[model samples]
Target: MSRLLRILFLTLLLTFTACSKDDDSEDGGTPIAGNRLSTGDSARDFLSDENFDELVIEVVYVEGYRPTDAALNNLVQFIEERCHKSAGVELNVRSFPSPNIAEFNIQQVDSIEKVMRSQYNLGDKMALYVSFLDGKFEDDSDDSVVLGAAYRNTSFVIFEETLHRFSDGINEPDRFLLESTVFRHEFAHLLGLVNLGTEMQTDHLDTENGSHCNVESCLMNYRVESGINIPGMTSEENIPELDSQCLADLRANGGK
Candidate 1:
């Protein structure tokens, strides 16, 4: 129940917030590949090319901290397989040189976003940041700890020292799988899964959580009580893919 609650709180915090900076003047000029962000915008309107043939993803990690080869491979394979197999869209995943990792309070997400935009000169590509912090995230405004978050065209997955320790009973393989799952989950938000991007064709939208789907088995499900089980990691078979309704929304938005 504790893990579930933590997941729910982080999920909701992202769903209700926007990543826009205070000064648009310093915005890296070009917008992210997807659509423009606006107040109250339910879906991102992507600026996909006419053919939708390519999409770029920038992966960045804190200096001196890196995921194992297996973990990194797992993430790359998952994104490529899912995007190609489901939507027929090709992905160009670029890894950036590690930047200085910041121990950020939850309230500093906006500031972090700005720093990232400036460091990478982010424009027309999705950015994924992985941070290795020894402490849990706290909000000066509130007591809820944030584990991970995604907004606009950027997403971050932080691995806290306390959460990933071997004593926690999550081994390396398991931890990597959990990390991969969280990556996909947050990236799905950028893709506008469920009711976040496009209106659903079916009644599968979880209205209570407006940003996620009602289907419990889907990757876009509002809450993940425990981490998702993926093939080659948790299960012998069964690769994780977006549920039908969510796929339909991606298809409609030039994803394929």
Candidate 2:
């Protein structure tokens, strides 16, 4: 071929290679959206239409602790259905054995620290801390101590034994939210879809829990997101489902 023809062929090849699908291996392999942004995004920024892929997930359960199999099943189902995940990676739901509850909690804290320190090496991007006990007590009285916690690094909790989740039919068990609902909210946090109001302050963040957001029937609307004006279990009506815009926000955030 002539020199001009050869040059033209090479140009086309380079263009095609540049447009190949993004594995989203950047941002520590967190699987970011097609675009990354520093400013907050609106509900329409990321949603359906754009290619969405599910990042690999890893969930660690402190062994010897019995929360509920229902919670586990619901959580898995939630991630599978809601997120734009087209299925790229596997979520490892792990359970480590520990006989001492006190010792285990301390270890859990330590493990979280380690994960943060070595985030560069770990895959799956996010990890969760799910518990049914208070730092002091194992019963309802102290359950109010803290409902949930997240470190903005995919860290948080769900008190399965809290008065809200208690079997006492009278209590109505708001805290014992459907497993899928809880997972949807937390995963959104890592994806940067929701804000963590204050460290260790469950009430600081926006939640549908026991309020109007739930009535909206969106995943972002959990009963816990309930505000003063919002009613309890408001998500019952709306469900806070994430639309296309939410998916875009996730892509730009590197999907913690």
Q: Give the TM-score of each candidate.
A: 0.64, 0.45
lDDT of each: 0.47, 0.35
* Leading candidate by lDDT: 1
In TM-score terms, candidate 2 sits at: 0.45
lDDT of 2 by residue, 129-178 (tens): 33333232232132132233332233344433332333224323233343
List, residue by residue over 151-185, the lDDT tens digit for candidate 1.
44444545443335321243223665555556666
On TM-score, the leading prediction is 1
lDDT at 162, model 2: 31
The alpha-carbon deviation from the true structure for residue 117 of candidate 1, after best TM-score superposition, in angstroms, is 3.8
